[model samples]
Target chain A: MSEADQGAVVDLLGVLAYAELTAFDRLAEDARMAPTLTGRAALARMAAAEITHHVRLTERLVELGADPSAAMAPFTSALDTFHESTRPSTWLEGLVKAYVGDGLAADFYREIAEFLPDPDRALVLEVLDDTGHADFAVREVRAAIAADRRLAGRLALWGRRLVGEAITRSQAVIAEHDRLADLIVTGTGDLAGIGRLIERITDAHTERMKALGLRP
Target chain B: MSEADQGAVVDLLGVLAYAELTAFDRLAEDARMAPTLTGRAALARMAAAEITHHVRLTERLVELGADPSAAMAPFTSALDTFHESTRPSTWLEGLVKAYVGDGLAADFYREIAEFLPDPDRALVLEVLDDTGHADFAVREVRAAIAADRRLAGRLALWGRRLVGEAITRSQAVIAEHDRLADLIVTGTGDLAGIGRLIERITDAHTERMKALGLRP
Candidate 1:
């Protein structure tokens, strides 16, 4: 691998490791917003799952001779911005973010993971598995929207905002981390390949939104 | 089993299930107060452990044909008040609360567990295992105190406040919920047994505080 390619691998793993840790943190905090104890514990379960995923990624980073903390430090601001800008105010909103926002992220990562070679691709593929979490969020959000039809409009707007903010943060990442971007293009062997990857991400995100009864 | 004994068992499990869930929530929230990413992950690991214990208790409640949610509802206010009244302002304070507050709770619960018959006693004993988490908190708090002697005075006061708040809530629980409290007494076979139980709890709390360099 080229030096730039190596940098990109580090960047990807670092971003992913921090992302899982932060997801665990935010989901735990979001559980407090749940109206029912049952709902609260459900969210906490999902949060706990994130920790296991985080452990797997950290192990991978360590095996690669990287300090997990230092590897994770670079993309902290971008992910933090995404979460801060899109903090969910209601339980439904929280579920939508979990289902929609994270679904989009996983879709994007899966697309990128395809470009990785050998075991890295398999490892990334393995960790990106969603563990059927979206089903719970989908059922919860869809039921809430059904009970209060007006929630449909507000939540639909919330879903759009979530996507918008996700895109905004993602674009910042692409702009600022040219090495990582170059790695994607070079890994795919063409610029058009990156274009198709973006298109695939957008398509999958639309499906996730529809699953949550929100318009993408 | 007497009908009243059965009710008490339900009450105990319900209260404990909720406590475990809330501990997971509050600990996850407290993790945000951690100064470093490494420290934050440590707390998150601790938070995840609470979920496993919570799941076990909930399973037992289900096996008894009780609705876990309804069972846990009664103790919600007490635990919430304890947490709200004792929200830790700093990382060290949070560590102290996690170590001292939870250590005391486990000690008390273990005493109560001994009063339970057979399976329940074994179940509670299984759940109360701390797995050396207190050592981490004690080390962190003591190192912080050593770094700043003035912090010792402030944290000592925090430790006292923690115990005070914990006791006040425990008193409220005993006053408000006769079923569970009666279980402790009748199960112990006398008031002296309960009195000795309290003394044992007090002794353990003092040891926990001393471990952290605080006077109980």
Candidate 2:
């Protein structure tokens, strides 16, 4: 890869690394809202899994001769802003955010992975794999919604809000990182290609919301 | 062991399990205070390690035919109170708490492990073994103290406060759990035995503080 390609790869991995770290922090904080000890433990396990992914991504950054913290620093504010704006006020809301919001982010990264070469592609795909807590969220949300049909409307709105915030932050990240934008454009073949990618992610987000008994 | 011994064991494991879970929560919260990404990740790893220990203890509870949540429920408030009272306000304070606070808890658990039967004894010791993040805390705290000699005074008092709160909470727990108190008394063979145990734990805490360049 050329120097420009290396820069793009670092930027991509850096955002993903910082995202995992922020998720770990947020999920752990959200665990406090859980009504049951079992629920809390489930969320804590999810948070722990994110930290494991973070360690891997940072190590990979070091191997690429980029300082992990410096690489991660640039994306911190954008990620923190995204989390801060969508902070969940309840346990169920937190679960939906973990499931719907993170699912959207994972889908976007997986789409971007297609634009990368060899090992980086493989590593990105691997870390983006589900952290095994999705089923728990689905079960809890579906049960809660089933018991009170009115909750569906409120949570559907929350789901939409999460996707909106996620998309806004992601666009800001790509806009600021010229190399990353070039890499995405080059991978997709044109500006329209990026548009197609967002459509696909949005479609997936709707499906995820439906899975949780929330209307898209 | 009789039925009373079994009950004591359950209570003991319950408190320890809850303690680990609370540590995981507090340590993850404290990670947010870290001044650097590396420091943040290090504290996160420590928090994740606590969850691992928690899983083990809870599983052990399950093996004994106890509901893990039920076993952990009884002591949550006491553990939560101990943490709430000593919440760290800064990164250095957080590091000292992780080292000095957690170190003191580990020492107490190790002492109690001796009174446990075979596998419980081994399991407690294994989980209490350093989570591989102690050296990170030691290094950070020592480096900070060296940079500003005055920091030593504040952190030293913090260490003392941690021990004082810990002792008070521990006594409350003992007073409430008659079976567990009886187990300790029986294991020690007398009241003086319990006194000796606390003295040994205190001395270890002092040595730990000295290692971090703080007064006991």
Candidate 3:
């Protein structure tokens, strides 16, 4: 890879590292909202998984001669803003966010991983693997919606808002980092490819919503 | 073991399980206070270890035919109160609490583990094993104290307060759970054994404080 490509990979890894760290933080916080000890433990496990991924990504950055903290610094604000703006107000909202929000982010990253080489691409895909939250969240959310039909409406709205905020912050992050933008644009082969990427992510998000028994 | 003995063991395991769960929660919260990403990751790792212990304990509860959540419920108020009363106000205070506070609690549990049978005793000791937080907390606390001498004084007092609150809540938990109290008394062989146990725990706490450059 060229030096520019390496730098772009670093940027990608850095953002992903910070993203995992924040996800760990947010998931642990959301665990507090769980209605049962079993549910709480489940969310806490997911949080732990995110931290482990964060550690792996940080180690990879160090191996690449990047200062992990310095590399992660630039992307923190955008990610933090994304979480802050979409802060879940209730237990079910939190579940929906964890499921729909994280699923969306993972989908976006997996799309980008198609642009990278060995090791980096492998690491990205591995870290993006589901941390057992999907089935748990789907079961819990579907059950809750079944008990209270009104929840589906609110949660459906919440899911849409989560995706909207995710896309907004993600775009802002890519715009602020030119190397990352260049990598995305080049890897996709054209502006149209970027369009296709968004379309694919949105399609996945709709499928996730439908799985949760919510309107897309 | 007899039914009553089994009940006592269940109570003991319940309290320990809840303790680990709350430790995960507080440690994750405390990670936010860390000054750097490295420090944050360290604390978050410790938090993850706690949750893993919590999972093991909960699984043990299930194996023993006890409802993990119900078994854990009785001790939550006391444990929550202890945490509420000694909530760390700063990063260093948080480190000291993680070190000194958790150390004291672990010491007390180890003393009681002597009465338990093979798997229970082994399980208690294993979950109580240091989660890498000891060295991390010691290094951070001592370094901070060396740089700011005033930290020793406040953290020393903080250490004392942590023990005090811990002792108070522990007594409340014991008083409220007769079977657990019986297990301790029977396990110790006499009431004097309980006194010796407290002394042993206190001594260990003093050693831990000294290790962190704090007054006992």
Candidate 4:
């Protein structure tokens, strides 16, 4: 990779690290709003995992001798805007946000991880939360929907809006970092493959919605 | 143990677990205010450890067949009040709060863990963040003081105020939960021992403050 590419990757990693750190914080606060102790604890555990990701990313940045704060600074405003705009107002809303928002972020990261250099790619892949956690969120959403059928529509809509906002903000991130976009395009081979990947993500999301008894 | 005693212990566990969970959240949020990425990530990692504590406590509560939420509910108001009243308005203030506040809480938990049953006691002991994390906070605070020696007096006073509020709120929690107080007193053998324990905690706090370049 060229010097500029390495700098860009470091920048991306910093943003991701800080984003994970802040996400953990926000989710922890949101856990207080949970209606059940079980729910609260579950969300809190999920939030805690972000710190682990943050630590790994920060360690890598340190090894690269980059100032994580400066590298992360450019993307902070965009990420902050995304979070502020999509702040969940209720306990259920928070859960949906965690489920849908994190799931999407993970999917995007999985794609982006392919674009990175050897050890970094592996590191990013390893840091993504396991399917067990994601499945837990899915199960909770499904159970809630089963208990109150009416919630399905509202939550499904909320999940859609969350994805919409995530995509929009992600585009903003990509636009601001052309090298990252170039890396993704080149790494994935073509736009068609990328589109197919998005379709798969959307399909999985729709399946999740259906599992929660909601129409896509 | 009698049924009521078991219930009380579960209650205590719930409160402690929830406290750890929320503390993890608050600390992670506070970490963002850190001046450096290394400092921020360090605190975030510390926050993650709290979840492990939460999980252990939650499992204990479940084993007792007690609802963790019900167990945690009674103390929520008091805990929230304490944090709200002590909310730090600046980055340094946040560090001081984490350093002083978490240090005191850890010391108190160490004393209280003695009253717990075998596995729970061991769990609590294992979950406490190591002195290294606390030492980092101490170094940060002391460095800030060394940079501006005049700031020492105000921060020392702030540290005292934090300890005072913590003590006041803790007393209120104990007063409200007679069973919890009895557990501590009985497990420790007498009121005098409990007093001595408090003294030890206070001395430790003073030492910590001194380490941070603040007067006891």
Candidate 5:
């Protein structure tokens, strides 16, 4: 890999690892808010999957001879800000955060994985959430909305806010890291292609929201 | 199950469920203190296992037509007190707690499992940490002690404090719940038998501490 490409990959891995760590922390805390033990356990299980991803990325960083902490440090503030801005207040909000926020992040990562090189590319692909989680989240959100139609509006707004924060932080990442920006532009071949990828993610997210009878 | 036996079983399940939930919370928090990605990931994996156990216990409560939260509520304060009194101060302390504390708890539960009926018995049996986790904790604690002989004194004291609190609370549980006490006494079939079981647990624990070069 080119020096610039290697740096970008390192940056991406760092962000992903730290994100996983923080997600686990947040979800574990949120699990306490669950109204039922079943709900709590489900959230906890989801959080656990993030830890596994964190381990894989950290291992890859070690193989690359990079200091994982140092690599993760740069994106910590931005990532923390995203989570802080979108901190869920209630059980449903927590579920929305996990279901909607994580769903979007996973989608973005899936697209990005296509652009990464060899080993890192494969690792990213492997870490992405599978269909089971997405389906579970869909069922949960739908059930929650069906229970209280009023929640649909509030959770939809929350989902949109989460997506907005994610996009804002993502743009900041691009602005601060030239190599990362270069990787995206080079891998996708233009801003339009990247924009189209975002559009696809948004479209799927909208369908999910609408399925739950929420405005996208 | 008899009416009284069912109540006692629910009480035990409640205690175990809450313990798993709180352990998940504490371990997730402790993961942040880890100096390396590998260490952090290790703690996170442990946290995940706790959540899995929580799920299994909660499911059993539901199967019994018990309210999971109600079943878990009675022992909340006592368990909380135990953890608060023995909170770890450092990464090494955290590892020691995870190794020694969890080891003792698992041993106690294994003995108690023989008293439970059918599915609950099987569930408790299955929920105990696999040998892999025990080996990991033992290896980590032993390596830490081998590297720093001075840590032995402090860690040994901590281990004793942990056991002291555990036993005190355990006795309180038995004293307050006649059915549970009866279960234990009947399960083992005499004072001497129970004494021998306690001795076996202590011996194993001392062996573990010795392996870590900590004074038993």
Candidate 6:
């Protein structure tokens, strides 16, 4: 691969590895907030799936001769801040975050994964694949909203906040990792490519919010 | 399987399922206490392994037509209390708990695993396998103890408390779950078998404590 492509790949994997790590942390903690043991265990299984992805991404990093920890270091703060600022106060909020916020993030990564070379592209796609175990989240959140219509308004606001925080963190990650930015801008052929990338991410986020019965 | 064997199997699977679920909960929470991102990930990965075991046991329970949550419910309080009472206060305490506390519990499960027939016995043995990702814990704790001899005094006490809490809960479980107790007594060919089982578990605990640079 070209040097810039290699750099982009490393940066991408690094950001993703850290995302999985933080996802595990936030979900595991959130599992504790679940109202039922069944709910808690389901959330925990989702948390486990994130670490499973982290293990794979880190393996690829190591294969590329990067220190997994060092590669993941740069993106840790941005991801942590995203989660910290958006900490879910209730089990419902936690489920909404899992479905809406993480769904958007995964869509963005899937977009980037398309711009990569053979094995790396495939690896990125595989790792980013649905952890969409968010089925439980959807069922629970939908039921909560049905039982109390007021929950819909609050959760809709939470969805907006999650998207807002995610965008801010994405920008921070882009500013801090120019190589990653170049991958999106140049890999897709120009500034318009970057525009289209952002647009696609936003569209997907809207669809997810709709799926969760929340207004975007 | 015999009716008694069936009851014994359900009780055993129930206890193990809850054990794995709580292990995941406690380890994930304790991962926060890790001093380094690397250490945190290690603990989180260990926590993830527990959930994997839980998923399998719960699957087996469902195959046998048992409700996973219902099967796990009986031991929830005992397991939760063990964790609640032994919540680690610092990074080192977390590591010690992961090692000594989990190690002893795994030993006990492995002993129980021996008497059951095929698939269930195989499943138990497999689930109880070396979450021995404790190499990290061993190295870290040994180094910390070497650096501060007085720390050993406190940690030794912590280890003892963990064992004490575990024993009290084990007795509570046995008292409450006669089917599980009968499995030990009859499955092992009577009371002497139980004696040998206890002896084996005690011996293993002492060895693990010594390996951690502590007294049994």
Share of true Cα-Cα contacts across chains kept by each model: 0.64, 0.56, 0.59, 0.62, 0.56, 0.67
Q: Write the per-residue lDDT of candidate 3 for residues B40-116, one digit (tens) a residue.
A: 98899889888889989999999999999999999888998889888899999999999999999999888888888
Candidate 6 chain B has its poorest 10 consecutive residues by lDDT at B182-191
Where is model 5 chain A poorest over a 10-residue stretch in terms of lDDT?
Answer: A129-138
Better of 1 and 2 by lDDT: 2
Per-model CA lDDT versus the true structure: 0.85, 0.92, 0.91, 0.80, 0.82, 0.89
Best by TM-score: 3
Over the stretch B66-101, how does candidate 6's per-residue lDDT look in tens digits? 998888888898888888899999888898899989
Candidate 6 DockQ vs. native: 0.80
- lDDT tens digits, residue span A1-216, model 1: 667666777788889888888999889989988888888888898898888778888888888788888988989999998899888888888898888888888888877877777577788888888787668888898898889889888998998898888888888887888877876777777878878887888899888888878777
lDDT of 4: 0.80
Candidate 5 C-alpha error for residue B188, in Å: 1.2
- Candidate 5 Cα errors over 4 Å, as ranges: A1-10, A59-73, A117-122, A131-157, A211-213, B1-14, B56-77, B115-123, B131-153
Candidate 1 local lDDT, B31-141, one digit each (tens): 998888878888888888898889899899899889999999999999998999999999999999899889989887887777777798899889889866667888898
Question: What is the lDDT for B37 in model 1?
Answer: 81
lDDT of 4 by residue, A1-216 (tens): 788778767966877887887688678778878777677778878887887788788789888888777777788788889889998888777877887787778778877887788788888888885736666667877888888888888887888898899889988888888778787787778889889878877887777666556677
Model 3 lDDT on a 0 to 1 scale: 0.91
The best candidate by DockQ is: 6
Question: What is the alpha-carbon lDDT for the whole of candidate 1?
Answer: 0.85
Clashes of each: 0, 0, 0, 0, 0, 0
Please state what fraction of the native interface contacts candidate 3 reproduces.
0.59
In model 1, state the lDDT of residue B97: 89
Tell me the deviation in Å of residue A181 in model 5.
Answer: 2.1
- Report how far off residue B31 is in candidate 4 (Å): 3.4
Chain B TM-scores per candidate, in order, are 0.96, 0.98, 0.98, 0.93, 0.94, 0.97
Candidate 6 wrongly placed segments (more than 4 Å): none
Where is model 2 chain A poorest over a 10-residue stretch in terms of lDDT?
A: A190-199
Question: If scored against the real structure, what TM-score would every candidate get?
Answer: 0.94, 0.97, 0.97, 0.89, 0.83, 0.96
Which DockQ-derived CAPRI band holds candidate 5? Answer: medium
